[model samples]
Target: MADLALQFGGDLAIGPTGDLLLSEGTTLTQQRVLRRLLTNPLDYIWQLNYGAGLGKYVGQPGAPAAIAGMARTQILLEAAVVASPAPIVGVMAQTDGTVNLSLSYTDAAAGETSALTFSL
Candidate 1:
């Protein structure tokens, strides 16, 4: 089954037909991965530990290694990512207080590699 398509920041996506879009394949996997990383833990009532909560690090001390490790672990938990070749996570803390996150992983369902870059 496909999920309602969502933009990077959780906005609803519109399809060419003037209706809500649905996501599948690589796009779906990327969306799910982003959601997992951005959502705060315990925010989702049913699954208290479902998220990496990357936002929690904002305005706090810089810990690129720790953040990257956390992201890598979270990415591997997704079913779409292959477990053998671990995801490569890069976290860069900018002078302006924002953090850049980059990752590359193999998508199990699509049998192809994918990369995502975003900020926190």
Candidate 2:
């Protein structure tokens, strides 16, 4: 079975005269998973207790504890999702107090290994 989903956060009206953007094929599925993993639990409509976004680590000093907390959340989120096999998640606190999140996963359907990085 082919898994598919509308790209998450496709609300931007950047088309010619403002049309909602869309993603198809494996890209759509990948975007959905990334959005879900990055979203804050209750921030999205009807999404309660569902996200790996910042968590309590936000606003706290970017210490080891803070980074570890965020990493734990990221790992949990990846495990909860079904798009990819177990992912390798890395979290690091930058000098400017931001966090660098790196995620690596093997796309079974596409038969490719992919890695993504985000600064939060």
TM-score against truth, every candidate = 0.92, 0.61
As for model 1, its CA RMSD to the true structure in angstroms is: 1.3
The lDDT per prediction is 0.89, 0.58
Lowest summed lDDT across 10 adjacent residues in model 1 is found at 58-67
Q: For residues 6-116, write the lDDT of model 1, one tens digit per residue.
A: 965668979999999999999999999999999899988999999999888877765677789889999999999998788889889998988999999999998898999
Report the Cα lDDT for residue 84, model 2: 45
Off by over 4 Å in 1: none
Local accuracy of candidate 2 as per-residue lDDT tens digits, 3-108: 3334445444344555554555446546655776567778877858666565456457654465555544555454333444566677777677777777766655
Look at candidate 1 and give me any clashing residue pairs.
Answer: none
Overlapping backbone residue pairs in candidate 2 total 0
